[model samples]
Target: MAKQALGMIETVGLTSLVEAADAAIKAADVTMTGWDKIGSGLVCGFFVGDVAAVKAGIEAAAEAASQVGEVNSTLVIPRPHEELGQMGPWIS
Candidate 1:
């Protein structure tokens, strides 16, 4: 498959992460690429798709997550570098 754009939203808790994930999928055509749980109760959701869709999805997710709890960070990479692919779901 061709390389896909990547989107991410990291929230304070699992429930918030789920909320973000739901909004992301609803707002755009994307697929869950990965999920991560970091210490101190941080939860991260990752999605991949077309550039525009990924941007929309991540933005929607961040907005939804913020409504629930603290949003640690958000990322939208239109065309992720090869190094980022190797990094995968890593929080660092």
Candidate 2:
């Protein structure tokens, strides 16, 4: 597998997460991995790609999500541990 970096963008709702994913993908060479719900109307969009691409993707996602709704958080994990990638939701 390629050396993938993981990006995550947390939004106030699933709708915002969807918009985040769309803009993120359009802005960078990244793939939407999946999503996780953290309750209380919080949802997170996951993406994986090259380190720089992941960073760019998450930045775009954050900006897009912030425009339509609230953005809870954003993160980019470059060269994430293999065990984390083995997690079910991280499989993409």
Instruction: Judging by lDDT against the true structure, name the best candidate.
Output: 2
Worst 10 residues of 2 by lDDT: 83-92
TM-score of each: 0.86, 0.92
Candidate 2 matches the true fold with a TM-score of 0.92
lDDT (Cα atoms) of all candidates against the true structure: 0.83, 0.88
Q: Model 2 over residues 22-66: C-alpha lDDT tens digits? A: 999999999998898889999988899999999999999999988
RMSD of 1: 2.8
Clashing pairs in 1: none
